[model samples]
Target chain A: MIFRALIPAFMFAILIVFFWTGLSLDPSKVPSPLIGKPVPAFELPRLSVPEQTLSSEQLQGQVSLFNVWATWCVGCRQEHDMLLAIADENLVPIYGLNYKDEREAALRWLRELGDPYAATAVDADGRVSIDWGVYGAPETFLIDRDGIVRYKHIGPLSAEDWENELRPRIQSLLDNST
Target chain B: MRVLLAALMLLPLAVVAIDQDPPMADPQLQARYEKLSNELRCLVCQNQSIADSTAPLADDLRQQVREMLIAGRSDNEILDYMVERYGDFVRYRPAFNDRTWLLWVGPFAVIAIALVIGVRVVRRGMGEVESD
Candidate 1:
C-alpha cells in the first residue's frame, strides 16, 4: 500500500519537475522596450516588385503592421493565412520584410500561398532584420498612426491571440485615434 | 647499400621529431587554437560559444586555452586537460560515455518506461463494469 501510494506521488513529482524544467528552459523570453518605440528607419529593395523599395516613412500616417518573415521559415507559413484574413478586412496596412530569402523563392512562396503584404521588402543579407533586433523570423510589430510600434507579437498568431490580445489592443488604439 | 642510405636519412628525421616540438613552433597551432576556442561552448552560458560570451568564466577559459597553446601543449593534450578539469560540459560535443548516457538517451528511455508502465497499469485497472 505504501509502495503504491509512493509510486503515484513519485510520478506526480517527476511530472511537476519536468513541467517546471520545461518552463525554465525558455531563457530567451526577455522582453524588449523597442515595441512601443518608432519603427527603425530603413529602406529595403522590393522582393517581387521591380525598381521599388519599402521604407519606414510609409508607416508614419496610418496604423500598420510590420511582419518579419522569410521563405525558408515555417512559422511564417502558419501566420500567412491569418495575415491574409487581416488584410482582407482592411484593418491596417500589413508591410512585410522578407529576411534572408531569395527573391525568386519569396515570389514563388507568395504565388502558392497568397501575398497579404501591402509592400514586401527583401532583406537579402538579414542586416535589416538584425537592426530591428530580430532573433528569428515570423515576428509581428503593430505600429500606431504616429509611427510608434505599439505591440510586438513573437511567433505565430492564433485565434486566442486575436480575441484576447489583438482585438482589445487594436480597439484601444483605434478608440484613441478618434 | 640502398637500405643503409635510407636508414641514414630516416635517423636524422627521427632525431628531429624527438627534439622539435610541433605545438608552439608552428604558426598554424595558434590559428587552430583560436578556431577551436570559438567552436567550444561556454559551460556556464550553456548556449553561447566561448568567443561570443562576455562571462568572466568564459574569459578565464579562453585565456587558459590561449595560455595552453603558448605553453607548447599539443591540441589533444590541452583538450584532455580541460576534459579532466571541467568534464564534458566544457566541450561543445560531449563524447558518449556511461555518465552521459542520461544526456544521450534519457528522453527515449523515459518515454519507453512511461509507455510500458502506463500500459500495464491501465490494463490491470480496466474492467467491463459499464452502466447504461
Candidate 2:
C-alpha cells in the first residue's frame, strides 16, 4: 500500500522538476543564429527629413546600432542617457527606428532630449519593427560591418549594459573589420 | 387618451424585460472589462492570457467578462461567479483554498512525500539479508 502511494508521488515530483526547469530557462543566454547572421532587410521613411529614406542595405561595410523606440514607451526615456553616451564615444554609428510614433511627437522628443542617432527612420505602422522581431519598444540590435546582427538587447540599455554587453561586442566587430 | 398613457408607462418596463442582460458599452465598464480579460488565463492555452489569446473560448470569456462589468458587478463578484460556475481552474492565479491547495502545494508536497517514502523503502530493503 505504501509503495503504491509512493509511486504516484515520485512520478509527480519528476514531472514538476521537468516543467519547472524548462520554464526557468532564459532565451537570451542561448546563442541565436540571427546573432552573427545578416541583419534582416527593411526600408522605411526618415522620421524628420521629408522624402528621405533609410534601409539596412546602407550599413554595408560599417557597424551600427539599431534602436527601436516609441515616444509612448517609458523605458525608452530611461535609456536616453546611455544612448547619448554611446553616441559621444562614436565607437559605432547609431540608427534609430521611431517605432509606432507620430512624426511630430518623435521629432519633438528628439529635439528636447538630444538626438543620438546619425539618422532616424519612422516606422509609423511598425511593419519594419515586426520584421526585426521587436515585441516592444526600447529594444536595441547591434550589427557588424558586413551587415550581420552581432547582438540584441530586449529592454532599455544601462551603463552596465554598455560596459558589459555592448562595448565587448563592438570591440569584437571592430577587431574583425577588414 | 387614457389607453395611450398606460401603454407609454409599460413600454420602458417591457424593453427592460426583453433586455435581461446589461448594455455592452460604457467607458468605465469597458476599462474594467479590458483589465479583467488581460488578467484571466486561457485554459486551453495555459501560457497566454485571455486578452492576448485568439482561442474561441477565450473570446467567449472576454465577452462574458465585459457583460458582467457592464452589469455593474464588482471585480470580486465577477470572479466569484466564474469560480462557482467553472471552478478555480478559470483563474490565472488560483486562490488558496482546500480544493486548490493541491494545485498550489502539490509539487512541494509530492517531493517531501517521495523523499520520506524512498528513505523508508531503502532502509527496509537494507535490513533484509541477501541470499548467496
Candidate 3:
C-alpha cells in the first residue's frame, strides 16, 4: 500500500528527469538524413571560371570535403584558417559550394584569405544547396571514395574539431577505401 | 492621367513582390502547395513555417515544393522527399515513429496517471469518512 501511494511521485520524478536531460541538448545539432547516403547531384558553374561547370560525378573515387559557405557567413570566416590548414596538408581535396553569394565578393574574399578549395562551385540561386539539404552556410560534409556522404559537421570548424572529430573520420575513410 | 497609368503599370510588379505567383493553373493543386509549404518548418528559422519565413533557404524550399507540385507529385511523396533530405525536424508535426513515440504518448500518459491518482485519493478520503 505504501509503495502503491508512491507511484505517482515516482512517475513525476521520471518526467522531471527526462525534461532536465532534454534541456542540455542543443536542438541545432539535429542529425542530417544525408549521412551514409549518396551526395546529391548538382551541376554548378565554377566560381573562378563561370564557363566551366563542376558536377557531383567529378567527386567520385576519392575522399573529399564539400564545404558549403558564403562570403557573408561569419561562421565561414571563423573556419577559414582551419580549412586552409587542412587543405595545405593535402590529405583530402576540399571543394567549396559558394551559396547564394555574389561572384565579385566571393572572388575578392578568396583573394584576400587565399583559396583553400581545389574547385569552388557557384550556387548563385542556392538551388543546388537545397538539394544538399543545406539550411545554413558553413556546413561541411565528408564524402567517401564511392561518393557517399560519410559525415557532416554543422557550424564553424575549429582546430579542436579537426583534431578530435574530422581527422579521425577522414583517416578511417581513407583506410577503408584502400 | 499619368499617375493612373503609372499605378496600372506597377500592378504586375506589386504581385511579383508579394510572391503571389501561383505555382499551377489548377486551383486544387495550388491549394495543396500552399498547405504543404505552410506545414513545413523552415530549418534555418526553426520557429517559422517555410511559407512564413523569408530566409533564403526557405525561399529555395518553397521553389522546390512549387516545382515538385507542378510535376504532379502527391502530397505524401513531396513530404517524404523533404524528410529524406532534411530529416523529421523539417516537418512541423513529426510522424509517430520509434524515435518520436515518447513525444506522442507522453502527454496522454501523464494525464492518465494524474486521473488515477486523483481517483485513488478520493476513494481513500471516502473510506476515512465512513469510518468516522
Ranking by lDDT: 3, 2, 1
lDDT tens digits, residue span B26-82, model 3? 889889988998999898888889888887778778888888988989999999989
Give candidate 3's whole-model lDDT. 0.90
Clashing residue pairs in candidate 3 (N, C-alpha, C atoms within 3 angstroms): none
- TM-score of model number 2: 0.54
Task: Give the true-contact fraction for every prediction, in order.
Answer: 0.00, 0.00, 0.78
Residues A102-151, model 1: lDDT tens digits: 88899999999999999998887665664565654688888899998888
Q: Which stretches of candidate 2 lie over 4 Å from their true place?
A: A1-33, B1-46, B49-132
Candidate that would win on TM-score: 3
Instruction: Supply every candidate's count of residue pairs whose N, Cα or C atoms clash at under 3 angstroms.
Output: 0, 0, 0
**Cα lDDT of model 1 by residue, B38-89, tens digit:** 7666654668876677654456566667777878788777766656544466
DockQ of each: 0.03, 0.03, 0.63
lDDT of 3 at A101: 96
Interface root-mean-square deviation of model 2 in angstroms is: 16.0
Docking class of 3: medium
- TM of each candidate vs. truth: 0.53, 0.54, 0.86
Better of 1 and 2 by lDDT: 2
